[model samples]
Target: MTRLDFELQFARGDFLLAATARIEAGVTGICGPSGAGKSTLLALLAGLLKPQSGHLHFDGDTLIDVRAGHFVPPWQRHFGLVFQDGQLFPHLSVRDNLLYGYKRLSPAQRRFELQAVVELLEIGALLARRPAQLSGGERQRVALGRALLYSPRLLLLDEPLSSLDERLKQQILPFLLRVKTETAIPMVYVSHAQAEVDYLADRVLTMADGQLQPSLATRDAASGLARGSAGL
Candidate 1:
């Protein structure tokens, strides 16, 4: 019974994430238009950015309680983030990058094994290669591997495929589906692509102009209604 509850408020330049959400041990999608604060919410959860007024918690662990002026360290939180660009260490071999987090965990808690994840993401052949040798899709696969290696309490994926070409997206998306099916790790997949949301989300949250909107028929369909000239 994993749980996460968060409320955050902040502004960077012109974007803001005045949003709240709850995740109950399953995949949840965060969908929104560009500049709607989707990534901002993820940053808050990961403790990479703190809010002006808010609190974050996971199963009562107290990740952030700004009211008490307490903030937990990001690394200690075990938040696994996979960004759109797939930020792998350019200098390290794929194997080293994946093993980095594994080495940090005590023997008892390490759940992700290299052979399993490497096979799952089809990265066995890329292990010896540096970042410069792989395609965009392959790089993202390695990023996913690194995140899984951490054994995260929650996975924060910020529009991971947004930067890939359509051809590469085809190659990578099935692997993501495989990831979702094979791992119990709860994920917050951020995307503006309704198609991706439709295929991957168990639940969806839609954001626009820093505010979250609810949809009885799902956001992609509801958004269609809001955009149509026809009266509801």
Candidate 2:
């Protein structure tokens, strides 16, 4: 099993974050309420934020070592991020957005193809449309496609379904399931909703008030909920 070991400490204003975690392959679900440090954790993992003193090792490769003065940039880290809002470029067509990351790959480093990604996310019909023209689910699907096209080693999802309605969430759930089963790439899914974590995660981590803990005791908290009530 691939593993990510982290011991991080960071502070901003009056808030402080002190978290230690070991993430493994498959989905590692992060559950917490709105004010929790869930997003802060993701930002650290994605290299968007640097910890004052910390260590991060993924599969034995050191990504960050504060003592050693080492840090990898987000692009070089090969992490794909999908926010609640798709964040697709308003000026680009869906096809362009999906192909954007694919084009960034070196000629010899190509792993994921555009056609395969399009098919995987079922976004073939929305290729020519712009971001403003697509529905919420459609935009998210395109965002997912674009991220996959980057062929990231890890996928980071921060409430990807939070902005969608019930019907849209239902429509996108199958694709998310496919993302888990069909790809070997690991994922860190961050959401406040326990049901969503239950349906998708292999391991659970709970965050609260800038702290993180393994949810070993409450592992089934979300699993006990009905699928419809879980809301994806």
Candidate 3:
């Protein structure tokens, strides 16, 4: 099982984050308005942003230790993150981009098979295409595929659907559902829309003013979505 144990306090310009959270194996949704520190939280967990006082651990591995002057770097943390913008390399083909980070893994440690990924993401047809040639949804899918191929212990999705229109979002939601159902890794999804949370069938963690609240108190399996469909 994956674990996230983090407590962070840091400031940048007018923004400050005093956030702590624990995530287990499954999708954990973080929903809040733009300034609620959604992306910041993800950055901290990814080791891109260091907290003045906090400890971050995944499973039994210590990712960050402030007291000992220790902070394992981002690449070593085994985190795969999808930024709001699809950060695929324009110079590389889809296949190459997906396999870019895969070379770091020893052959025995490569849990995700390449053919399985191509079939699951249906990226085979587009493998030869460059990033600049892809549609918004396609680029996002490629980005997702790339991150997944990296064999991350935990995945962080920062507003994966933020740039897409409603139709595009609808088109892509199923991919996310497939990710949730098929993969065993825990996902930390950051979003501004509650509807997206429900549509993807994730456990919701609402954020406000740079703090994460207790997880949602519902078990209907459809509670988060029911509220989303009603425009909550």
Candidate 4:
């Protein structure tokens, strides 16, 4: 099913982002080199940037329609975003950081419990520590747990593992895979790492010069990765 339908156009200075896409459930990975406007597209989907003219629909719900002068704000969109840097609150303990957004929602709106997310990410031991006290991978895991605890309808991840070393990336990949398999939450993953995208994305798209297109090669790679990882 089409989870997100986008026909978006936005411009800043000389750069113009003209993109149309139908993102289905599961992970849709956006891969492109630097300056390809991948991040901009994510921002638009996150409702952080309003399109000049276009429509964005999530599950048939209109998120934005330029013609109607309608746009949903980021907080109202129910999208959980995890950026490259982890972006945790420096002073907040890991427990508080996870509770930040989770607490914002009324009990009725809460979908994922704190204990489930903590155990899912295996961050129970780190809860008492602050962001500064954790390692890079541990911090990212905490960030992921925080996002999941928000019970977001969609998760947007932008180069989440880019800052980590190869070993750290390996350490975190399984946790991400577990999230995909266990939570079943739809995700839009943006990264320049082809291999990472291939391993995690069910569908692959490429963004370049403000345009989005399917990457056949990446799609094939993803298929292979899925087959290979089935036993794991």
Candidate 5:
């Protein structure tokens, strides 16, 4: 399994984020209240945001080395991101969106079997519909499928279930669990809810005051108050 190691320092206005952690295979949950830099950290990992100074290494491969003036672009990182909003294109049909990233990949680069992912996410029937035609849960499933179809080395999820109702949360949680047990890809899941962390994460990182509180195993999380800033 590939391990991602990052030591990033970034600041915006009065808020400062300086933290370092190693993310392993399986889901590593980043839990904290709002504005705790969870989203910022994920964005840095995905290369959507550059750190003021730091280095990011994946499985010993250098992705970003600030001192060396090296940085990998977001698309080249091969890290898939799913936000709270599905972020699907309104003009595209479900099939088109799922195929969006997959289509860009060269044939040899395609690691995920299209048919397999389609069945895994149960999105085959929704292909004909547009984004507006699908429910919130259905949209998230499609989003997940699209990301997986790209054959990403790592998956980044930022509060993907936050917008869903209780019923939809229950509906989509199984798919997430399946992804955890059924796939080899590693994931970094960001959320403020302890229930989500308990449910989906094999390990947990607590972020507070724009910093990582401690690198604690999930077992320790339940015993203490998960201290941190509010959501962003």
Candidate 6:
């Protein structure tokens, strides 16, 4: 299994984040209350924020080493990010938005095809529309498709369902499960909702005051939850 090993420290004004983790394949959930530095940790892993000290490695490849002055940029990391707001290009049509990163990759690097992703997300009918034309759930689906089209090494989700209503959350959860079981892309899902994490993650870890707590749930429990939530 692919493993992401890190000992990272970063300070932003009064907030200092220090976290160490060994994330293996499958979904590793980070659950905490707001301001617990969950998103901060995801940012560091995604290369959006640089750690002040220590190092990060992915499958034995050094991605960051502050002492060595080595850092990989966000784009170079090939990690797909899906934020709560589904930051799609306002001016681009759904098709264009999904194709943006996909078209940039050479044919040999394209692991997912456009049709398959569109079908997977059930967004084929909305391709001609722009971001402004879609509902919240639709927008998030397009954003997810855009990421999957890039065939990222890891998928980082920062409360992607937080902005949606309960109904929408239910709608999106099944799709997320499909992504997990179908694509087999490793994921780091950060959410404040314990139920959400418990339902989706193979391993769930709690965070508080910028520190990673012990594992809260096992893979068997999560799988049981998934099996029970089939109607979702």
Best by lDDT: 4
Model 3 error, position 80 (Å): 0.6
> Tens digit of lDDT per residue, candidate 4, span 1-232?
7788888999999999888877778888888998899989889999999999999999889999999999999999999999888999999999999999999999999999999998899999999999999999999999999999999999999899999999999999999999999999999899999999989988788888888877765565544332111012
Instruction: Name the regions of candidate 3 deviating beyond 4 angstroms.
Output: 215-232
Clash count of each predicted structure:
0, 0, 0, 0, 8, 0
Model 5 lDDT per residue over 181-206, tens place:
88877888898887887798877888
lDDT of 1: 0.81
TM-score of each: 0.90, 0.91, 0.90, 0.93, 0.91, 0.93
**Residue 58 in candidate 6 has what lDDT?**
92
How close to the true structure is residue 86 of candidate 4, measured as C-alpha lDDT?
93
Query: Which model is ahead, 3 or 4, in terms of TM-score?
Result: 4
lDDT of each: 0.81, 0.84, 0.80, 0.88, 0.85, 0.87
TM-score of 1: 0.90
Question: 48-122, model 6: which lDDT tens digit per residue?
Answer: 999999898998889999999999999888899998899999989999999998988889989999999999999
Query: Order of candidates by lDDT, top first?
Result: 4, 6, 5, 2, 1, 3
Of candidates 6 and 3, the better by TM-score: 6
Evaluated at residue 75, the lDDT of candidate 2 is 82
Model 5, runs deviating above 4 Å: 215-217, 220-232
Cα lDDT tens digits, model 1, 4-57, are: 877678777766657766566656777888988888888888999888888888
Model 1 lDDT, residue 154, Cα: 86
Displacement of residue 160 (Cα, Å) in model 3 is: 0.7
lDDT of 3 by residue, 1-232 (tens): 3377776777888877777665666778888899889898899988898888878788988888898888999988889999888899999999899898787888876879778878887878998999989999999988998888898888899999899989989988888888878887788888998888766634677777876775463233353331211112
In candidate 1, which residue ranges exceed 4 Å CA deviation?
Answer: 216-232
